[model samples]
Structure formats: structure tokens, C-alpha cells
Target: MARARSEERRAEILRAALEVIAERGYRGASLASVAERVGLTQQGLLHHFPTKEALLIAVLEERDQWDTGGAGLSREAWRLDLLEPLVEYNAMRPGIVQTFSALLGESVSDGHPAKDFFTERYATVRGGMGAALRAEFGNRLPGGLTPEQAAPLLVAVMDGLQYQWLLDPESVDMPGAFRDFLGLLRGAGDGPRG
Candidate 1:
């Protein structure tokens, strides 16, 4: 019973932490703020996460596998199972997107706890997206752009688009952008498609 209760409290704190961090940048976030978000005391927050860094790292780690086993992240193909679920998740949990964007800004310094995590994550995500593209257009792409060369560029485009969409929600359609980006990756048509 005690273990279950502890786990529940930790989950509560993590959910509240996501909101707090997303609303207020990492530098602006504090244990006190998190506690207020979830109606806990600052000391209560500390019981689960001894420090801000601990909480931040835990949140990021949890996000890593919260939906694990649902998506096969690989360097060969994209199971619609994987990308579609992420698309669904993004719609269901806009907070996750906000939290993810917040962390990208926070994960700059090599000494920052979140830096390495984001770095590796971006690498894997970029690689996976690239690999999926290569599978779709291995022989058709002009000059045979390798996955290694194309993956990072695709990820960069997605990241840049994410920023713009966040700033002007009405100005951008994420799914449409993703579809167009995928087309570009496969050396398909140049302009937007319906």
C-alpha cells in the first residue's frame, strides 16, 4: 500500500511538473511552483524528487518510454504504427509537445542534465525518420542521398516547423507539413499537397 501510494504521488508530481515547466520555462520553474500546480507542499514535491534537476531528468526519462512498445523506432522503416501513434499522441497531449519544446531550449549546455538526453533523442529520431525515407525512396532520390545525410536535415526542418507552429497555431498545419516533408524526403512533388 505504501509503495503504491508513493508511486501515485510521484506520478502526480510528474504530471504537475510537466504543466509547470511548460508554462514557465525551466529556469522559471521551481519546486514551489510545481507543488502549487498539484496542491502539494514544496517539501512534498521534494519527497518524490529531491531536487529540480532530479525531477527534470525523471520527466524526460518518463517521456522516453511512456508509450514504449507501441512504436518501433528503427533505421530501416517507419511502421505507420509508429508515426501515426505519435501523431495521435501529439494531438492528445499538446502538453507533451509544449514540454518537449521547452526542453529543447533548456538542453543546450553539455553540463545541463537534459542536454545529453535531447541530443541522443534527436539523433535517434532523425535517424529513424531518415531511415524510413530511405526505405520509401532508395533508388528514386536524385544522386542517392544517403539516410545519413538526409536524416538530420529532415529533423532540422521538422524542428523549425514546430517552432513556427507553436508561435502561430492557425498559421500552420502540422500533419500537412509532415506529409509534405515526407514527400520531399521521398523526392516526390515540390509544392504542398492536399
Candidate 2:
């Protein structure tokens, strides 16, 4: 029972931290602010997460869990076709998307705690995307590019669409745009080009 209570409180603190990070970015967010949101003192918060870096890692892991449907990490989890649905899902949860984008933007700075996480994550994601493309289109895609060659563009389009959608949801239909991109991928062989 005590363990359950502790787990519940930890979840609350993570949610609070997510919110604070979403609004302020990780660089601007403070441990005290996160603790205040969950009605705990800073010292009490440290009892759950020993350091701000620890809490940040937990928050990022939790976000990944949410994205992966709580199944933990699996190589087969992400595919080209599933990306549109993921974008649509992201559209419904602007706060989570905002938090992710904020962290991603801040992570490029030197010595950011999330820099290593994001770096490793992108490598994994790019490899996964390349495998997905190979599975769907064999070694080469319709545009005559190998899966390895095209994987980064796929990642870029997905993340780039998120940023555009976040900045102007009214103007950017992220899911729709992603679907259109998929269409382009599929029809790349049929079009004339320079």
C-alpha cells in the first residue's frame, strides 16, 4: 500500500514536470516549480527524483512509453504507414507535443542533459525507419533511393511537420500533410522531374 502511494505520487510529480517543461522548456524549468505544481517541497521532490537530470530522464521515458502504447521499446513498433496515425494522435494532445518540441529545441545546446538522449533516439529512429522502408519497398524506394538514403528525410518530414503544426495548427494539418507525403513517396515513380 505504501509502495502504491509512492508510485502514485511519483506519477503526479512526473505529470507536473511535464507540464512545467512544456511551458518553460527544460532549460527554463526548475525543480522548485515542478514541486510547487505537485504541492511538494523541493526537498520532498528530491526524495522521489534525486536530481533534475533524473526527473528529466523519467519524463522522457514516460513520453516514449506513451508513444509506444506502454509496450516498451520494440524495433517493429514504428513503420512508415503508422506515422500518419501517430501524427493524428499527436494533434489531439498538444501539451505533450509542445513539451517534446520544447525539449528537442533546447537539446541542441552544448551539455544539455537531453542531448545524449535525443542523439541516441534519433539514431534508433532512423535505423527503424530505414528498416520499415526496406520492408515495405525492398532495398530501394520508388524514387530510386535506398532505405538508408531516404530514412533521414522521413524523420525530418515527421518532426518538421510537428514544428509547423505546433506553430500554427489552424494553418497546418499535420496528419493530412503527412498523408500527402506518404502519397508522394508511393507515387514518386509516376511523376516527371528535373
For all predicted structures, in order, the TM-scores are: 0.71, 0.80
lDDT of 1 at 144: 57
- TM-score, cand. 2: 0.80
Q: Highest lDDT among the candidates is held by which one?
A: 2
Write out the backbone clash pairs for model 2. Answer: none
Question: Can you write out model 2's per-residue Cα lDDT over 1-194, one digit (the tens) per residue?
Answer: 99999999999999998888768765666899999999999999999998787787788789877777785445676767677788888898776677677778978999988889889889988888888899999987887788898889888998899899989999988887877777677754333322
Query: Can you list the residue pairs that collide in candidate 1?
Result: none
Off by over 4 Å in 2: 1-8, 18-30, 50-54, 188-194
Best by TM-score: 2
Task: Tell me how far candidate 1 lies from the true structure as C-alpha RMSD in angstroms.
Answer: 3.9
Candidate 1: segments with Cα more than 4 A from true spot: 1-5, 19-30, 37-39, 67-81, 84-93, 130-143, 190-194
lDDT of 2 at 115: 89
lDDT of each: 0.69, 0.82
